[model samples]
Target: MGDLAFEPPRGGPTLWEIGIPDRSAAEFYIPDPDPNYINKLYVNHPDRFRQYGLWARYTDLYPDGDLVYTVGVSDYKTDWFFAQVTRKKDDDKYEGTTWQIKFNLETVNQTGTYKLRIALATAYVAELQVRVNNQNSNPPLFTTGLIGHDNTITRHGIHGIYRLYSIDVNGALLMEGENTIFLTQPMSSSALQGLMYDYIRLEAPPPNNSTKKI
Candidate 1:
C-alpha cells in the first residue's frame, strides 16, 4: 500500500513495513505476498485498456500496447527495457503466464515476506531472478489472462505489473542467515508502446497495529 523505492543501497535490509506500492492506475488484489501464498490474478481487458498508464493502444501490428523505451528489449542496441502487449483485439480475456526468478544469500538468514513486484517499466524486462541460498522459494506465480489476446506482437508483451508482496516474518532470518532472490519477466502480449517498473522492496510489520493508516 506504500512505495519503498530507491532506498539506501541494494542487498541491504529492507523497509521495516509498508511494502511497495503499485505505480499503475489499475486496482490490484494481492492478499499481500509472503513466502507461503502463490497468488494468481486476472486482468480483464477493455479494463487493462480502460485504466492506468496503459491508457491507450497503438496501431502497430495488432491492437496491443507499446513499450515506452526508445530501444527495444531485444534491440541489444540500448539499455531500456520495452514491454508491449501482444493481444490483437480488445475483448480477449488475456492468458496466463509466469516469470521465474532466483535469489541466493550468504547466510540464508534473509527471511521476510518476498514479493514478485510487477511494474510496467519496460527497462526491467530482462530475466531478473534473486536466489537466497539455492532454493526457488515458491512457484505457480501470477499473471494476467490472455483469452482475447491476438499473440501477434512476436515480441515481449505487458500483461500486468507484479511487486514483491513482502509479508513480515518475526525476524525469521535470524534463525537462518544469508539468502538470494530471483526475478524473471517475459515480454508482454499486447502491442501497446510503454514499459513500467515501480520499486520492488521487502517490508516489516508495525507493532501493535498502530502507526498505520490507509
Candidate 2:
C-alpha cells in the first residue's frame, strides 16, 4: 500500500509480503477469505496475457488528464499485459513474479501532484512508461527506469526506485471520473520486472460526495 522496495540484487527479488499472517500495531488486520478470491481469479493463469498478447488494457481506459496516451509493453520481447497488480498472487509461490496496473483511491483522486512507488517483485529485465488518455505525455514522467541513454539506467542497478513523473495532465493535473493505469512484465522471467507499482499517492481535492451525474 505504500512505496515498495527490495534490498538489492542477490536478495532473490523482494516482494511485499502478505500483510497479516500475524497481528501488528502498524499493519492492517485482514482475515483470510473463505475461498481466497485471488486463488480462484481468472487472470492469474500463465496464458491469460498470452490470449491477449503481451499487453492488456489496465483500467477502463478512461480520460482523466489532457493527453492521449499510446501504450505498449516490452518484456525484452514484445509488449505484454502484465497482471497481478497486487502483491497477492494466484499460486502464492512467487507472487512477486507478476506486475499489475490496478490503482487505489489515492491514485483515482489524484489532484495537485502524484507519485508512484515501485518495488521489484523479482530480478527481471524491464522498462516502464506512463500514458494518459492516449498519448505518451511529452517528456514522459517515467522511462525505462533509466535516464540519459546508452543502456545507462538511472534507477538501474537492481531494486529500481523512481519518483514524481508528471504523468498525463501535467500542469493541468488529473481529474476525477474514469482513468487508467498500466503495468507490464513477463511470466516469472529473470529481468527488470518487479511489482510495477508499490502504491500511488496524490495531493488531491477533498472527497467527492456529489450525486450529480456527469
Candidate 3:
C-alpha cells in the first residue's frame, strides 16, 4: 500500500472568530426598506435586501455618526449595518465612513504574530484601511489599496466576486485589555463606493507542536 499521511490545515490557530466564514453577509443586519421607496416584488420576500433606498437608511439610522460594533454586547443581526457606506450630509454630499469593532483581550502574546482574516462579500471601487487600537495611525496596519469594481451594492445583490485577505498583525500592536479595530473605506467619490464584509476573524500564533499524521 502507498504511504498516506495527514497534515494539519494551513494558517494559525484561531483566537477569536467574528461572524461566520461563509462568503456572504446575509447573516448580518439587513435593515427594513423605506416605505416611500419599496419594491412590490421583493416585499416580504426572502430577498428583502433587494429593496431600493436601503443604502440611504444608514443616514436615517445613525444621523450623527458611523457604526460602532461592540463584540460581546452588540447583536450582529440588529446592530451591525449590512454595508459600510458613506454618510450623507445635510448639504446633499457624501462622506466616507470609518467603522469600529471593539473587543477585549485578557492577555497578550508578545512573541507571537497574530492573523486577521477578512473576507469581503463585495466591494465597489473602495479602499479598506485597517488600524489596530489607533484610528489615526499614519500608516495603517493593513490597507487594501483601491480594490474591487463589482457594483453589487447598487444591484441589490447580496454578494459579488469573493475576496479574502489574510493580514499578519504584529504582537506589539495588541494590548492586554480592550482593543479596537478600525475599518475605513476612504473613497467618497460616490455613495456606491463601499464594501460589504463577509466575515472577520482574529487568529493566534501557531502552536509549537509538530503536525499530526494518520
Candidate 4:
C-alpha cells in the first residue's frame, strides 16, 4: 500500500460545520485567549514547541538509530509528525526503542485535574507511562494494545486519538515542576515499521479562584 498522509481539514469552515453560527461566533472563537478557566497547553505539532520562546528541551530519543527522529511538518505526507523508532538492520533487536516529550509546569505546587490527548499509530503493545521528577518506576499509566481490538480508531493519519485524564494511581498530578512523560514500545520487527506519534495535548483544570472575595 502507498504510504498515505492524511491532512486535517482547513479551519475556515470548522465552526460552521460544527454548528456554531454567525457574528457572535467571534466571541466563541477566541484565537488568543485571555487567561481564564481551563488553561490548555496543546503539544499538537513539533513546531509548536518553539512558540514558548524558551530554551526548554522538548524532544528526546534513546538508543538512537535509523528512522528514529522528528521530521519537518507537512499538511499530509512525510514530516507531519514524529516518525516511528526503527532500528537499523545491524543494530541489536533487543536494544528496544523509546521516545519522550517533556512539559515544564510553571504553575506548580497546586492541586487540580490534568488531561492528555495523544495520537499514536502502531501494531504492538505500546506502554504509555509518566514519571515525575525522573522517579517512580511504576507500571505504565495506560497500555494501548492492538488497534482495532482495543477501542482504537484511525481518526488522524494512521494514529488513533488516545485520551488520558486521571490522577495516577499514586494520586499525583505530574509533579509541581519538571515532569517527563514517556511512550515506550517494546522490541519487535513490527515496531521496526515505526510507532507514529501524531500529537499530544496536556491540559490542566482551572485554578480555584472561587474562594476569593470579589
Best model number under TM-score: 3
Q: Which has the higher TM-score value, candidate number 2 or candidate number 3?
A: 3
TM-score of each predicted structure versus truth: 0.28, 0.31, 0.90, 0.44
| Ranking of models by lDDT | 3, 4, 1, 2
What tens-digit string does per-residue lDDT give for candidate 4 at 50-121? 223111111222234322222121122222233333343344343334544444554442443445445443
lDDT of 1 by residue, 103-147 (tens): 222232233333333333233222332333333444413333222
**Tens-digit lDDT track of model 2 for 1-214:** 9998865222111112222211111121111222323344424443222122111122212112111222222121122222222122334322222222322232332332333333322222444555543334454454555322221111212113332232323313443444454433323332223333222322232234222222
CA-lDDT, candidates in order: 0.30, 0.29, 0.84, 0.34
Q: Candidate 3 regions off by >4 Å?
A: 1-10, 209-214
Model 3: pairs clashing at backbone N, Cα or C within 3 Å: none
